[model samples]
Target: MDPDDGEGLFSDAFPTRELPPASAFPGQDPHALGGARDNILEVAIGREVRSFRNKLGITVADLAAATGLSLGMLSKIENGVTSPSLTTLQTLSRALGVPVTAFFRRFEERREAVFVKAGEGLLIERRGTRAGHQYRLLGHNAGNTGRVVVEPYVITLTEESDVFPLFQHSGLEFIYMLEGEVIYRHADKLYHLTPGDSLFFDADAPHGPDEMRQLPIRFLSIISYAKDEV
Candidate 1:
C-alpha cells in the first residue's frame, strides 16, 4: 500500500503466512503413541539409534557435535519425532562407527506366527508323492524365512502307496506318528514307529519308510535348518 515507503506495491496482496511449529509434521503427532504401531520404522530406528549411542557412552550433545547437527534435530531423530533422511543417517552412521544397515537390524525382528485351518493345508508333492504318498503343507507360507527355516507337512501313506526309502535333504527332520505304524529308516537305523511315537534325526543321511508296518500311516514331518546354511 505504501510504495514510496521502501515497500513493494503488492506487499499487502502477498502476505507472508506464519510458519508451522518445529514439533509439528504433516501427518505425525509427536505426543500421540496410538499411531506408533503403524510407524514401526520410526520407533525401531529411534530405539536402535539410542541403544547404539548409549552403548558408546555418549550424550546427545556429543553426537550432535560429531555429526554437525543441532541438538534439537538429534533429539527428534532419537525420539522418533521425525523421519530422518538417508544423508542424515549416513552422517550418524559415520559418527557411530557402525554401518547404516545396523540401524535396521532390530527393525525386522518381529513376533511371527502362522495358522492353518484343518484340511486347508496346501497339497504338495515330494519324491514319495508319485509313489502314492500325500503331503499337506501346514505352514509353508511363513516357513523357510527369518533366521531359521521350518517346514511342517502332514504325510499320509495308504495301502496303495509303495515303500520308498530314499529321501535325503538338508537340515534336521522330526516325525510324529499320528496314525497306523511304519518302520522308518535313518541311514542304517530302522525304527518301528507306531501311534504316539516321535523320531528326530539329522536329515543329511538318506532316510524314508523302510516298510509300512500298518496301512493308512499318517505322521508329521517337520524340517528345520539355519538361514545361513548353504
Candidate 2:
C-alpha cells in the first residue's frame, strides 16, 4: 500500500505492512509468526536476488561459477530454506554489482507509523490469511534494507517456538524486554530473559524467543546493523 500523499518532505516514504496484534507476547506461542515473517522475507529476498541475476542475464550456473558456490546451495538460499553465509553472500553481491545488503531491501511502496498507547497497544494476532505471530512496525520504513533495518516491535508469544537453526549472515540484533519474560534460544542453549533484560547477538546464528511466561511478552527488537551491500 502507498503512504498517504499528504504533508511534507518525507511524505513519499514507503508504506509499512498492516498492523498485527499488539497484545503482549503470550508465553505459549511465539513461533506462530516465524513462518509467515520468514516466508515474506524469503519471498522478498528471492525476488530481489532473481531480479538482479536476471537483469544481468546471469543463470544459476553463471552465479555458481562466479561466486564459487555450488549451484545446489545457491538454489536453496534463493528458495529460503537456508540462509547464505556472509562470505558467500559477499561473493554473490560482488558478482551482482550490488552490496550484499541489497538482497534484504524491503521494497515497501507505502510507509506509515502506528503509535500504541501504554495500555492500548494493538494485539499481535494470527489470522488464517497469514500464519501465527503478530507485530506492528515501530516506525515508518526506517531501516528496511535487507542488511540493516531498525524496527522496534512488540512481539507476542502465543506458542512454543521451534529451534530455529543458526542463520549465517552478518548482522547484530539488540532486543530489550519491555514486559513479561521469554526464553532466548541460541544454538543448543536456552536463556531465560525477563523485562528490562537486553540481549544482543549475531543475526547469523539462528535464534528466536520462546514465550514461557503466562503474561504477554513485549520487547524492542532492533536489527542494528546488516552487512549487505545494498
Candidate 3:
C-alpha cells in the first residue's frame, strides 16, 4: 500500500477508473465505423488469397492442385473459415507465385493519413448545383484500393449562396456546423443546426440545405461510400 505506487484506484496521475478503454469513443458518432476486431487477420488473408488467385486466372481447384491441398481445405482457407499454418501459407505463396508475407500484407498494412494545412484545402466545383457556395476539399485518401471511400469537405455558404434542396447520392453523409445556423433537409426531415451542431443521414435519399438562418455559414461534410466493384 505505497502511496507512491501510482497504481491505487484513485491515484492523481494514473487513476485506473478514469482512463477510457482503447476502443472507447467520445460520444455517439453517427458516421463512425463500428469497432469489430474479431478475425480481421483471417479476413484480410482470405481476401488477399482470393484476389491473387483471380488475378492469375486460377480457380480454387487449380490452387489446391498446385498446393497439394484438398478442395475443401483450400475453400476453407480462401473463405477465412479457418486459419492456415505457416506451411500452408508457404504452399499458397509458392502456388500463387507470391511471397508468404503477401498473405498478411493487407492485415499488416500501414495506416495511411492525409494532412491539410489551414486555407490549403483544394477548392472544388459543385456540378449541377447553383452558385455562391464554396466547397473546399479538406482531405481524402489518395488512390486507396480499399473497400470504403471517404471524402471530407468544408462547405461555406454566404448571402449570395443558393439554397439547393434535395441532393440525392449513394452512401452516408455527416455534417458538423462550424460557423452559422442553417436548416438542413434529409428526405422528409429538417434539422436546424447551429455552431457545434451535427447531423448524420443516408445519402441515398435527397438532402441539402433548406435555409440559411445565419450568413457566411460553414460546415464540415464527411461522406462515405463503397468503392466500385473491380
Per-candidate Cα lDDT values, in order, are 0.81, 0.60, 0.79
After the best TM-score superposition of candidate 3, give how far the Cα of residue 64 lies from its true spot, in angstroms: 18
TM-scores of all predicted structures: 0.56, 0.37, 0.58
Model 3: residue 82 alpha-carbon error in angstroms: 18
Ranking by TM-score: 3, 1, 2
**Root-mean-square deviation per candidate:** 26.7, 20.4, 14.5
lDDT of 2 by residue, 57-101 (tens): 989999989888898987887776676677877888898999977
lDDT of 2 at 188: 39
Best by TM-score: 3
Q: After superposition, how far is residue 145 of candidate 1 from its true place, in Å?
A: 5.5
Model 1 ranges off by over 4 Å:
1-95, 99-105, 108-112, 141-147, 226-230
Winner of 2 and 3 under TM-score: 3
lDDT of 3 by residue, 74-121 (tens): 888777788899999998999899998888887887676788999879
